[model samples]
Target: MESIYLPTSYRSSKNLETAGYFEKYSKMCPLTWGGSSSDNFCRILEEMALNDFSEVDLSALGASCSINKLQLPSEPDNFPIEVPARLSTKSKLDFYYPVTTEATQLNVIKCKEALEKKWIRSEFKFGSKRSLKLTITDNMSNHFRNDILPGTNFIYSILIYRPFSMSMGQKHSGEKLRFAMEIEALGTNLLSQIIDAIECVSNYGVLKEVENTKVNLKQFQNAKQEYPSQTVFIDGVFYNDTRSPDAEDYSEPVIKWAREKNIGKFTVSAMETTLLNTLTPRIGYPYVYIHQGNCEHILTFSDARLIQPNDCLVSEKYPRIVSVCRSTNVLCLICGIAPSQWLVKKCDRFPQEKVFLCTDCCNSYLYIDGKKVGDFELYPFFDEKVT
Candidate 1:
């Protein structure tokens, strides 16, 4: 991708506004009294006069997440686009705003009422089939400065990926393909860039799962195309069990694609969906998820509700087959950030919702997905290594 170029001088408000991204936030902020909306920190930086700007790469200070071309042998048919978020009349606190807007937007509450009455957010599509999408954030105002005070600020970010039209560096027939011309080359905060880098490297978790799912879909479709009545052999891979004796049954298994597969390794998927992790009572071969980790050995289940932490580890007195799923070898729920007791408590507060099972040995956790299991929960039930 070519470097993004902005004018050095802030001669035109339009140039300066777009350079720092004033429009994005302004759109996000709902307008009252018929004024402009607000954008987020990314946009704010985008609008910086090229002269005032030092560097706009990733980490906003260092090398960016910019890659010339990234190739994934297996990838999703469609990756969901991130909706752009606006600074609320309340968000004025989370970031710096236009000096002029700041003075008027200072009255956060009053502005909110006005935005609620007027402003509307617009959605932008990036992919050819409109497979990927983004929506401009509605604006908000806030009152915060200096202190680590949590106010009505909504943390926002953009969903980034290999844009469909983006030029792949590998040329075909001596011709090069071009990518999106408007992708902001300027990076965000240092921590954000770090997070981005982490995501870029670690996303194998989600990518593997998504690719596996897509492969399964392709196999199923292929089966239907070749022989409608035939059972779809889902590549016969270790992680392809999916609990069903046959996969051609459901139209869409509808699994939640991993949200944190920023790295490019293995996906931390549910035991049932992974290689060598399941049983096909009538079939010749059982399903599996592990190339090595024998998660199937200690996976236990119970009709009893496995809701509480106590359920994870039973006490001797009441332990007459509780839902304890353990492992002699290490198990990890390494998906996203490790959830805390406080976060668990929050889950408890909302019983209808799912709780994360990520723990010390487990790198990540997923709770209560379809079929009574969750995403990324490992089950040690595999008998042999998957080829």
Candidate 2:
């Protein structure tokens, strides 16, 4: 693939020397042509004439010669010096080749093309190809300044990954790109807006406290309102989502506990207090995003650029999802084919502590004629599928 050149301020010169500097000497010097031994005298004068001597008499060196008829020295057998061939050895630390900005961009383009081709050939189509639409609310529009126009604002590309472990201090292991989105309203948009745009499968997960109870998948339709607790940890401060009346401040308790333990001094604030552009977050640095109470995700700022005219003009589509991870459904342990809907725990029938089961398997294996078989806790299991 052809490498795309990035916009650069530096321009390379066509010639190293200044115009007419070396050409003047080349024409005047007799050494440039194969002249007699007496012409060596002129070479000495030519060198002096070339030097920065303003007081020197340049007319005394005689007129320049026409070298068209002058025969140059015959080529010597060892005229040009030859360099010893060195073995091309790389250091052990040099795992990857040093790539220029253009090369890096070309590699990225090729990878994207390959991924697109794979997506086209794959069986799963709908969820993997779909984009998340960000509806612009009236409140969001009200905050937009009249001075800041559509294309002038700074844009940010955020890459979010699924947290491998629930531990806050532990580094996220493995490579799993959950969401790749672009947001244009950096100055006007609040951190709360960005938090609201983030969607996770755990938000729709079912929770059951009682044992020997049937799990209802339909109950998740209104589960979002029941679990509105979310918090974003950026820099050293925690930004809590306090939009909903029932929304719990997950940061306050953590901040208080941290203060008590003398781990580190941290502050908690509402997500609406800070603007996206104001935060000086380092690109590729991992940040914590907790939503639906305990479901955590690692968020990182991938790239940032000024909004251009080619970008989407619609103000409603500012926070647009450009790329998404392919949907991967968790299969039932018993059936091994159907997607799991229920998570059964503490049952003697199952060997493991917890096992995923489809609705049909859960109904048949766990229950007998509409009555619970044993003391097993049942909860609805939401797969990692984005749809």
Candidate 3:
């Protein structure tokens, strides 16, 4: 297999000069107004300026134009024109705008101007497809400078991986990106404070269970009360969220199991006291996030950088989500259109052991005359959509 190499300047917008690309390209290309043929081009332009347009032979000048005779590079034979089939299913957010009409060109210019004046004060990188960067509005920056106390802060880009399912694990990559979020926080901020800001889809699952009469609502309410029983496994230690009185030490069992297997001793700490800057987090390394009693997610520190002048300066809005992935809904298996509300397990009627059904299908298929038809377990199914 042949690999195509892209220059660092071409791959990242950060490395490129902050000038018009066309001007740079023209300077680099010898034939484009920079070569010996420039004199002929200038003479033609001078002639056009002096002569009347109706009398000038435009066809003769067009034939003599140096730009028309310029040779351009052809595409490589092995260069892939179409994206790979495996990557076709992946979703992407497009930031590029094509100049199709004068109106559209004006709109693009206005959009850039808005970003410059209102949103981000610094140069915004527009070409990178893999990363999303956001900055505070100019008003927010001004407010922070005038009213807020000066302190050390950091911008963190976190990639949240999807919970593993049978299909998810079988895919090429075991980890599929559920969503990515960028947050701004002070270095003095507690780990627990940052964790609280992170909103998960599983949190909605507990509330969705209330819809199922088979399960007790009190159980879910109790679970919600114990929601702080979360842990973040960073480096070699586990940081447990023990703010609530009912918060359980979820790290004990895991540490015990690791010890039994002869793995190095792991220490557990209270997230409430641990500062965000105190921990050494490696970029792109997987960290374990256990929340809502065994709902696991792979959390990776995508980026960490010092706060800039353009960053959100409001202390109250610190640890706020700057960028988030679009929500995706899982449809019910039976109806195939409505969002799944119930999960049916160990049933003879359905082909699969576990099945997702909507409220209507669950009631109609699993019950008759206000009673369950078969000896099967029914639980509220919460789709992965973040409400």
Candidate 4:
């Protein structure tokens, strides 16, 4: 991906207003009026005129949850031309704005109301088909400040991914793909909400779940093409499903094609549509598990969610159950910093609740009584490993 270029001199009204808020707050007088709909911090940063502005490449952010460019092995027939970038408007707060309008003024008023009532946080949705959904936030924002804060008051944003498209092809077109973007503001103080919207966007945005309901699977299964049972050589490998009990059943061409190329690096026995994680079960839907990869993962459809956390432990109460993070708004018990994901260790002392340790805190060996006890290990459900 090419670097994003923005004007070096043009300051967005949002930034100017934020600077004004800080200025007025020092004198104990607060600004209570907002004029424009907010954009995500990423998009805001992209537009600002800064001499030393830099954007973090999503692809280089590593497998830690991010708004990454979606890549597929090969194009399948049912690929979505326009994905519904749904913006979730729910947050952990007392007030609620279940319905939102396209009007920017209404949203600004709604944000102000939430602040006046002492609401700590709120999320609003904005977007349509093929466009990125913006998760506009309203929160009493007291978070980290990077280089942009000193020069410009900017709204923070993060990329959110939800399972909406089924990728089957390896090659990608040169055209730039538009990802779902979410925006948030953190109110600095009681006045920040009225003056400058300083709501913070969560770095750990929600990844979409694949839509794999049983009804959808049945429809897909019934709609698949039937092929005669015969031995076929694909890529110099003998591809034969004739001996299987379900050999006569119709197969989706993508799965058959994947099998030919050994797409997921294993035998494709059964394609079951199931939720990826037990915790985030219904957030997204219909994830296609290619069955046995080198291992048995309930939601191993793509590389993003496939990689197991290095120090994660299995649930003693429920085997074969995988959870991405123990809690949604969890603070590292050892570090105090909020992480996108956590390395969860089962609490033998209290089996009901688990302990969350951030990667940095875990690396430092959070100590007690002269003993290092934060090292964690994975409880593998299967033996095979994939590169």
Candidate 5:
């Protein structure tokens, strides 16, 4: 049977690269390319499709993964000629996709075909090679926490959960996906806020601004106005080096390389993500049904007994809960949907200790002293300069 294709999760992308997308160059200079920032976002995301890290100049990003220095190639391979190939390998700009069990790579083969817009060949390749032998480790759970909620799943909610979840846009249910996109779009701005937005949304961010037509909380329906989360994710870049501390020290090759990558891959990818999410349905995956009543009941995390009534430390942030989980100290979600309700009730009822109330919106309330503190938000923003 002809199989259907879902967008490959970042996990798959990482796996493909890990299996050997850009591995050949590991021997010498592992110079790879990153696209532009204007239209693309080069950050990495998790299963929820929420970004944790984006466009980092490999050198400046401070190589964190395990490293094995490459032996300078000029040491011998026909050395008398003073060749640089010993330090670098060539690669090309291509598209990636997962269809059925197969993944395909498309490179710009004809020059004229790429005349107006182009993806350069980083070094050189033989028979239409488009991938490298780079390995992508799956450290998603290590980086993303249950608290970091992305955006909502409008299409999925309506299609997959409408029958059971009550409404597509429940207050606290099924939001991570949409939230991630929204945050990625502007959250990629000013690295710190991007991080905070990520944190606010991550470990414990809120989603407001979803249109009224989506979901109308009975309580909020009568309230004045509230902000819902918007969902947007753009394409980005990955640079090869850190910018010179002294601005004047910048080199033309580096500058040009930056521009080229952005224009060719980064920009293209960003535009596509934007266009698709805005105009298309089912942005990437068909919502996978986990249960009957609510995904939040199963997908969300909550632990209440973690906080002792005597543990009175003030937290200015989400002043809604007094405590959350014990070991992780994360926020406790009673149910993914209608979560604001947790704030109004006494959640310390041991038998139901896993539940609690967040009166943050009630009056001088915040989300401190709970397990939600310091969760992973979308990380390392796009190519924007960090102050």
Candidate 6:
């Protein structure tokens, strides 16, 4: 794999007089590299050059030792200069994206190759070795989620879902095998680095924009244009439903309704989700799935609203939701899917209480309100009070 050469604003010296000892020096640096920001990393690296001892000689100092003291090792052999080994981060980037138009089979292969063997070496100014081995290595693999919705999978590689992700296109039901390109190195700005590398070696591009598609609820012939129990609005964007327009709703009746209508497919995109989450944050993130009827639904939070709902709470920052197992308060109790129709049953423990169940989990037997209940059988011990 050829290392993708990305244009970086910052570069470090590979030929400083102390270059030979950097490997040993890095081991002694006090800064935690993996978690530090790019600017902090560079600052720390500069500090190393200022006092080479800060990099190499301080290894003998215990964790409590002060860097200002700059203690030298009592035993020279303990700090014996060894061949410079390339330094890398213990973390690896797992690049997973649906195979969309912006990314093709050939593009995926090129990226895989670049990430597997290519090393992104740094360009040094004064060192005799112009190319310094930057923190990038070809360590990648392919994988799939233990559970993926059958229809178009709007797969994402983000650890924490970001709003910007919504602008990108999505995968259709036919698409499979999300490209999980793994790159390991000791540095930051990995996403930018990968984009640059792919651009250099291959035509594969990321974050490609597609023509926006308006959602049609008619496809889900059974569902009304009704909103969910909770309506949230942020920055002019709204989140109202759990499933796509044509897809099955979270409640059993709604799902059965859509199934009876013979709804075949549904599509949702990260772009749609980004629209909703850009302003509002929810406990559940956007996800894609294939339903029992083979219908595809792209879920952002639960569902999004193009038209503002009559009732909604507006906020500027991401709002947090406390974990509760109630359907009306959130989504489905079972899968967390958007609950269109809810099953109301008497709590086994508190006869006065009502328990809500989503469509899929309604008939499914499970423990509710501290007691076991049959599909459609109301538990006698469960409490209706959610909370």
Q: Which ten residues in a row have the lowest lDDT in candidate 1?
A: 297-306
1-387 per-residue lDDT for model 6 (tens digits) = 001221121131121222223334444643533233666657775766743556445555434464323444552424332323563332144333334443343433344535434333221222222112223211121222222111111111221111111223555524432211222211112222212221110011111111111223233222122211222222123223443454333334443554687643222222223321122222234333222332233323332222111111122111222111111234555567544234344435334344545544654534455445542333211112221
Candidate 5 residue-wise lDDT, 9-69, digit = tens: 4111111111121123332321212223322233332333544545574444435431222
C-alpha lDDT score of every prediction, in listed order: 0.24, 0.60, 0.59, 0.28, 0.24, 0.30
Question: Which number leads on TM-score?
Answer: 3
Per-prediction TM-score, please? Answer: 0.16, 0.58, 0.60, 0.19, 0.16, 0.20
Question: In model 4, which runs have C-alpha deviations exceeding 4 angstroms?
Answer: 1-121, 124-287, 291-330, 334-336, 340-342, 349-353, 359-371, 374-387
Better of 1 and 4 by lDDT: 4
Per-model C-alpha RMSD: 27.3, 18.8, 14.5, 27.3, 28.4, 24.8
- Report lDDT (Cα) of residue 382, candidate 3: 52
Instruction: Give residue 285's lDDT in candidate 3 (0 to 100).
Output: 63
The best candidate by lDDT is: 2
Query: Regarding lDDT, does 1 or 2 come out ahead?
Result: 2
Residue 263 lDDT, candidate 3, scale 0-100: 69
**3 against 4, candidate with superior lDDT:** 3
Q: Which regions in candidate 5 have their CA more than 4 angstroms from the true location?
A: 1-225, 234-347, 356-387
Q: Compose the digit string of candidate 3's lDDT tens values, residues 295-322.
A: 7877766666554434455666666666
- lDDT of predicted model 1: 0.24
What's the TM for model 5? 0.16
